[model samples]
Target: MRLWQRIFLIGLVLWLATVVVTNWTGNSNLVPTVVLFGSFLVPVTFVVWAYGRGRSPRVTVELLFVAFVVGGALGVLGASLLESWLVHPSIGMYVVVGLIEEGVKLAALMFVTRHMTKRTTMDGVILGATVGFGFAAFESAGYAFNALFTSEGLSLRQLVETEVLRGILAPVGHGLWTAILGGVLFAAAGRLTTTVMLSYLGVSLLHALWDSMNAIAIAVTLALTGHAWQFALLRIGRVPHVTEWQVHVYTLVNWAGLVAISLVALCWLWMTVRSGRRRREILSQ
Candidate 1:
């Protein structure tokens, strides 16, 4: 079996064992283990897979490892600092968040790969994906950890659910976004050209739309169900109880939005990869 396959199987087994042990023993110390393992497993597996698939001869395992660790750390830290200072609760909050997060991840990728004399779109995709997965892993850990604590107390079930959901969605999130950005950045030879800027904006828009999808779904549900007046109640700190049908509609809308966004991102990445390969071929010739 390939290395990524091995990593996924082993990591999945370990994470499951950790979850079982923590739940059986009610040991708080093992909580961190479960959170980290569950959060990092998918991202790590995907990164290894990307490394195996990447054709850039200059990109090495060691560099990918560093990008995954250091680049992810820098992205997370920079995003947190900037978001805390600049973000506020508003209609455009997710948009700002998308901009800040994608910006920082790009910066982190650039920082980690700064010394490379030769760069290619494929290399950027691999390394950018490494950094993005790193960010996703760390960010997922935080979300899982927070899910553990609630008003009622420790919530292992909630934590597990959070991890599972995020794990399932990991590939279509930060990894995909940064992969697109990195391809553009590297295609421009590290310059912030207009094409690169447009790619950044495009990914950031996707990010914002993704983050706001649930709310958008809710709004759509309300409108469809003739409950749009509840928006006023929400504005005034009241959450009007949603009908069962509305809940179903919201779920459908939310998931449909996510699927559409994921499809678009996947298509964009495919085009980017194809363009990169063509560029490489021309250069080689």
Candidate 2:
């Protein structure tokens, strides 16, 4: 019914599904409670903050929630489908995958939270976080599950450390980058501001670049190594039953890139808001 209510319900359901599946697969104990909570908590908080900021109608917020869920499912599915033909799938080759996923998630946010005002900047930031959150929630489940269900469980120390790092980093990963889209585009359509869509395109491009970084890296790696086999790309839906340097790169780089993107988004939002306020003051005189 309400946006927060729906987000809570969807989040709870996904969490439960994550726990139950891990349990069945013998990775139950590997599920870090803190990591799971942190994964959902940050983004959901952003969603709540956005709700207060936009005063968007109840129905539209619900749609945003749906965007999170539906967009994630579609993103993973698209990734899987695209990788079906290749030796393994990667997000880099198909920039469309990133664009479509973030675009749709942000679109849902923009359409539902429509309003034209500089005042909605914080909401934009929050919703951008929400989009990232939705993507992270699903993505985390896959990673956590991979860690747990493999032949052996990670040591308690390793488990604790990995989860802690991931927890700390999760907010910035997919959710914040997508949040840039949500934040800027929402501002554009609602605020009647010039350069709004252009700014949004910039945000979206950053998002696509964020996904493509590893792909590009892998390609370079392949070329330099002079390998004929497709050893450079990440093999999706297949964990090596243990973490390695390459896997670590994939995990940590994604986290770091998103965090960097967030810093950039924050700067953009800050400038947009300050300039808008100055413009308003000038016009008021």
Candidate 3:
């Protein structure tokens, strides 16, 4: 009924229609069409949801745009540089990537909000959602592009599949984590305190777990398949043939891990919002 809800519904319908049409026609030309639509669907919906959730003093359109566009671009660029320089094929690589990414996003949040004299927790939530979704959109685009290529050739199906999966998972990923960090950062009122550092570390750990789920699943599968689970397994390409039972077990564990991590992140975000609301209420009293 609200504007954001209506917009999200419309976007969803349009995205579904595009997917149907593109797949029916089997036109490679429409690859980009579906990719962009599907990639933005989840991020946009979550952003609208965040905007509607914070019915308080609204964040300005200009600031939200800067956070979504400029902040997102900066996050991607910074994360890429840090990941390239510091990350390698290792069990711990996901942790490093998570720390770098969440760190850069927080920096981007500060960059966008630095000029403001008064910022509230809600402002951080909305702006943080914008920046996170922006990062999601850009990162999804890159993943979609890469999905087009495979061992065989151009794979439109794979591209669409990648977009859809990432889009579905986008909300609980970057956006949620950043919102938690942003809420804490703003509550700190620019103070470098232990609480802020701990919050950042917590979100970074969530990010690491989210990113490392697949690797963890594989390790578990390998162990069950009688292959000794080693950190080296993570660095190797093309897992040795897994049994059908092992495959099923891995799939179940992988999906469960994903869902568990998402629920944890969502719980953290909900707690942050509740705490922020309480703080505001007490301040007003």
The best candidate by TM-score is 1
Instruction: Please give the lDDT score at residue 137 for candidate 3.
Output: 93
Q: Output the number of the lDDT-best candidate.
A: 1
Tell me the TM-score of each prediction against the true structure: 0.96, 0.54, 0.89
The digit string of per-residue lDDT tens for model 3 on 133-219 reads: 999998999999899999998877788789878977887889988988888888788555898889889889988998888889987
Predict model 2's lDDT versus the native: 0.56
Please report the TM-score between candidate 1 and the true structure. Answer: 0.96
- Error of model 3, residue 206, in angstroms: 1.0
Per-model CA lDDT versus the true structure = 0.94, 0.56, 0.83
- Provide the lowest-lDDT 10-residue window in model 3: 226-235
Per-residue alpha-carbon lDDT of candidate 2 for residues 6-102, written as tens digits (9 for 90 to 100): 6666765665565556556756454665346535554565557555655644325665676566655555565455545542354444455555555
For model 2, the run of ten residues with the poorest summed lDDT: 234-243
Ranking by lDDT: 1, 3, 2
Extract clashing residue pairs from model 3. none
List candidate 1 stretches off by more than 4 Å: 228-237
